[model samples]
Target: MSQVPMITLNNGVQIPQVGFGTFKVDAAVTQQAVENALEAGYRHIDTAAVYGNEEGVGAALRAVNLPRDEVFVTTKLRNGEQGRDLVQRAFEESLGKLGLDRVDLYLIHWPAPALGTYTEAWAELESIHRQGGARAIGVSNFLPHHLETLVEGAEVTPAVNQIELHPSFQQPATQAASREHGLAVEAYAPIGQAKDLDLETVTGIAREHDVTPAQVILRWHLQQGTVVIPKSVTPERIVANIDLFGFELDEEQVAAITALDSEERMFPHPDEGNFTMLD
Candidate 1:
């Protein structure tokens, strides 16, 4: 019953500010979860090749009976498939799994800097965008330095940069870098994985706003002009996550939440080159 606001990407494409994230969601249950999200008015759905649930997501999309253009679907290229040739094949494979000809957004899942092939992979994404296979293209888990390497010889600036952003790990430098390049920031772990939802600052703000700490954190993300994809398989939480339009966090509340940034990451640093998932 809540309306999700849309944010304009650099390419003039509008995306829902809050989306449903399918990370760590079991493939067996993904379809139902996505169905619930769509029913709850989540038009944007974010998943990745690494999540291994694209097939289920596709099934849900097909089952929903909504117009294809009514929903915004995003999937990412896997780390192993980082070369131009491999990326093309990977995109086709993801498309086949999703049962859709075009995705609303396509992202390079990670820079995988050690592999040293992201620039080439980015070229392939640009081609996909030009050919209309993807409405917009972006990168995930990319730090400022990684983005710098990507844009050196690139033709199209990345439309979005999905990163490990939450209250505890605000990623100010990376967020600033993204804004500098006209890239929209998408917060992947926007709720901090429930790690800091109970922090005094978060709870105090939640109490002041009379909402859950998760909602407060998500509101903070929204107020900061970032897109947030909070993952939840529970139907109630899925409904609650998008019910964020009613309240607004004040300047001091926003500053208090901003001060909670501890510079800690819930996921591995991109520079660590943790591509074991590819294996």
Candidate 2:
């Protein structure tokens, strides 16, 4: 059912490279937004406990009534829920909210290096994988050093590293580290929070391809082998986000977009802000 390309994780779990993201999607509208996404042919849905909308994602899954195997659902453990024991409990809570027996992918939303508990939490994630509670386990917002530390201390190498990535703020070092460690780089804010949509390089390419700048940016991500999860509640935008399989970007077009990387991250760095989950 998915015409979108699938990126096989290190563990052999195939994830749709272009998934629907629900970062700030309000809980009240998350279900409908997710429904719009599913109806528009999105087979992957990324959410988190901090987002407070797993229930909506779950509802959309049930409403869409696609074969469970056909959809790859990813949710993260909240920053507040990072203890060895707490992570397990958090995973259960997320599963309950999503109404799933097992998730396709479960990630620690942040490394939370200040807490000094990520390694312990990773241990529990490994145990969960062993027990079939999660098909894959990963970390989000981790930088290169954090990735090095986590991989050094943990048994299960993360299957994916979800991070802030867009044309203007691509973290090349982090991407290199993730690839070096065998983790798939999953890009959140794939469209640069609308900041990169109007850049001359992106727009020029978009005009050449007869697509939106958002589409151009997304196409750039896909061509470079990163998984992109772009969020949108608007029905037209939702449909347009996943409409990426029809065209291919040639070498020069891809390079021009790649040249836009400024290392300017649009979101909080892994070690910078409050480690606590959002309200």
What TM-score would each prediction reach against the true structure? 0.97, 0.97
Task: List runs of model 2 lying over 4 Å from the truth.
Answer: 277-279
C-alpha lDDT of candidate 2 relative to the true structure = 0.89
Error of 1 at 200 (Å): 0.9
Alpha carbon deviation, residue 191, candidate 1 (Å):
0.6
Measured with C-alpha atoms, the lDDT of residue 161 in candidate 1 is 97
What would the per-residue lDDT of candidate 2 be over residues 1-50, giving only the tens digit for each residue? 35788899999989999999999999999999999998899999999988
lDDT of 1 at 162: 96
Worst lDDT run of 10 residues, candidate 2, spans: 270-279
Give the per-residue Cα lDDT of candidate 1 at 212.
Answer: 87
The C-alpha stretches of model 1 lying farther than 4 A from their native spots are 276-279
